[model samples]
Target: MGLALQGEKIARNRFTGEKIENGSFMLCDFSGADLTGTEFIGCQFYDRDSRQGGNFSRAILKDASFKSCDLSMADFRHANALGIEIRECRAQGADFRGTSFMNMITSRTWFCSAYITKSNLSYANFAKVVLEKCELWENRWHGAQVLGASFSGSDLSGGEFSGFDWRAADVTQCDLSNAELGELDLRTTDLQGVKMDSHQAAQLLERLGIAIIG
Candidate 1:
């Protein structure tokens, strides 16, 4: 019931500190825009009929947040999403293939940052993305494609990782405590420095058919 603008070209515009609730921005081109500190709550960015979401490719989204937004199938490829927060949103099938959350210090060194907590990232594609040292806790990663992705040193605790391929990505040094690690084969995954709770350890043991006498 808020602002509705579909298929519009709003690229390179600055929308800082604006809050839009229950709005629809389907197929809008927001490329090269600066959306710093902007909040979108309960908004619709995907057009189900046309099967396309708003084009946010290459946007500067520093400190921007989305809560309870339907960003299904949205194109967020190659966006500068540092310090961005997404909480309790439906982000299924969203494409974040080349998003940058890193601040490079040299040619071969960088530290990444972002806060994507308690959101549903089911079926979202994060292939080859570098999200090291970020806060990605309590999110649903069901069937998400993370091939060649590196989530090292990230806080991925309490996540629902059903159908996730652990061997296809590098999750070393990640905090994966209290997460539903579905079908995670330990032999194929290198979980060095990865943290897990006792329950999760037991679950992994049980999955490997190891009987616990105690």
Candidate 2:
């Protein structure tokens, strides 16, 4: 017996620390809903007729799994999303700020324009996924596989890029100022229109065994 939230307006509903497994939340308005410590495993948050998508703004989704759902434009601001799995979903233009996304993986999904600012994404994997034109400011991606992904026009300033192969990715027109590049082999990579200081330039040249002359 699962909780049924189908075709209902459940906005502003506070269901904190509830174990809502195998539930149907289709065509439901979860906007401004307080789902703190709620486990939404095997849940459906999509609408077939309206295509209005689900709204999860300001919801605490710590350890939540939203598998096989259409969550386009879902707002998740200031949410605790640690160890979350959003596999095989359409999550475009999702707003997620001030969230802890450590050990979260979105496999075989189409995610674009995700406004993930001020989030801790350490050990997160977005590789082989084209999540372009995203606003990523002051985020941490240490020990994450960011290669094989195209990151164009994304502000990657003050971000951590340690343990990622930069050669396999296309990072053009990106702001990489004050970012931590931990021994990345950039001998052959598309680095055009990148915003970097002299220190960064020196690091790149040093990797290629090219020393700056005084």
Candidate 3:
């Protein structure tokens, strides 16, 4: 159905196995809805109808946990994502570009070929997440937890992963220039083919127990 329910109340509805196509729900409320295995096409989830964002800010999506759902090309720009669990889902090409997320939790999620660049991702939890071929540049990820996650072939330049367990993940062939990697364990991470910021070189060198000579 080509539903254009912008800024409507879609809360507490069971959208189990529903197929949304070209649906624009910008500034709408999808809180407390059962979105198990729901697919989307050209669907807008964030508040994009105006300058502000977040359509499902107060929505509850804690229903049946199923896998194999496609959310490609869906727009979530500047959306409110408080208390949302994006567990075990495939977000291929889901447009999260320029979105600032607050208190986000994504476990066992596959962000393949997605664009989340310049997003504020502070105070989030990403366990068992796979961010393959994603654009995550210039994002703030301080006070976040990344466990058993892998970021391969992704552009993570200028991202802040500080003040957290920045290890316990495989981040290969990705850019890291101008990024905050303080208190991170490099014993398990590689610096080859990775761009580094000149200001952050001393911290990286100090972590390797190497003193710089003037």
The candidate maximizing lDDT is 1
Clashing pairs in 1: none
Best by TM-score: 1
Give a tens-digit lDDT track for model 3, residues 134-155: 6677766666546776666778
- For all predicted structures, in order, the TM-scores are 0.94, 0.48, 0.50
Model 2 spans with C-alpha error above 4 angstroms: 1-112
TM-score of 1: 0.94
lDDT, residue 102, model 2: 36
Top-down lDDT ranking: 1, 2, 3
Query: Comparing candidate 1 with candidate 3, which one achieves the higher lDDT?
Result: 1
Clashes of each: 0, 0, 6
Report the C-alpha lDDT of model 1 over 1-214, residue by residue, as the tens digit: 6999988888565466788888889888888788988999999988999988778899888888999888888888999998888888888999999999888899998788899999999999999999998999999999999999999999999999999999999999999999999888888999999999988888888878997667
List where candidate 3 sits over 4 angstroms from the true fold: 1-111, 188-193
- Candidate 2 lDDT, 125-168, residue by residue in tens: 55554545566666666655555667776777887777657776
Which scores higher on lDDT, 2 or 3?
Answer: 2
Model 1: residues >4 Å from true position, as ranges?
A: none
